[model samples]
Target: MKNFLSALAVSAVLVSCSKKEATPVPEKADTAKIVDSINAARTKINDSIRSKNHFKDFSGPHTFTHNSIKNPGSVHFEKIKGEADHYNIKGDIKSGKSYVHIDGFMAVVSDKHMNFTGNISESVAGSENGKLYVRRGTKTFMSKDGGKTYRLQDMVNGSGFVEYIDIHF
Candidate 1:
């Protein structure tokens, strides 16, 4: 009887030790879904770049369409007499007692690509106090698909202000 009881106890311990819950296996990620999500994000960013904002917000890293930039302000461009692709460009932004002056030389590489060399200076004669701001740099703007969408190149440290502005000619 004693031996039988000892055998039964050992069997109970073995049964308890063998009973274990199985771990769940994780499902594999769907590659197609991930790709689609990434593509959607890219499309959203590209669309925003193609959109236009007010001239005061013309900060760089954005693309501008010819039609979108129309009549934004007093913008003018004159071709250099002897130069094939050289042009003198100027723009003015006025709001009540404040104004900004943008002057530059544009070198057009093609209908979709161009380079700008110039300065954007502004004088604000507001109620508080007057202030002056000036910056000079060269920036290249290009479009991958002809003239539909254009973007600026080398945006790192491109402007002394918040961002570099795009001037469409």
Candidate 2:
């Protein structure tokens, strides 16, 4: 009888030891689904705007003339040190003695729109540093020696223009 009891105890211990433990499964996050939903909503808004032809009035054909600043060798805007909204615009005109260097601030109108407006804070041409306004998708104008002089670098065929920059934010 004692032997029978000891055998039963050993069998119970072995069975308990041989059993496998179950591991818990982790749940997946829904971040990807949320991002996809936001992207779909933005696309729907853009499609609605396009269907209404909201941007049709701002479209025009570009004509390059001799007066235009032709063939800019290289143009680049670098952020100014210690200034978040300020930038240094530097560029060279091909085959021309003129050089352009200006300080400006870029303002974003929307997630897809932006513009630059500032003074020709400095220039090599002369003391003609004046207000420089470059409206994206519209026109670019520079005033030299203050507002006393104005030069149209680029413009559409209309008197008034709406400017916007194409960008995805």
Writing each residue's lDDT as its tens digit, candidate 1 over 1-169 gives 9999999999999998896898899998999999999999998787665443211222222222222122234556666654455668777766555555667886776677777789766555542243665657987877676554445564333223233334443
Candidate 1 overall Cα lDDT vs. reference? Answer: 0.58
lDDT of 2: 0.39
Q: Which is the leading candidate under lDDT?
A: 1
Q: What stretches of model 1 exceed 4 Å from their correct place? A: 1-71, 123-131, 143-145, 148-164
Candidate 2 lDDT tens digits, 56-80: 1222222211123333333345554
Against the reference, the lDDT scores of all candidates come to 0.58, 0.39
Clashing pairs in 1: 60-164
* Cα error, candidate 2, residue 5 (Å): 84
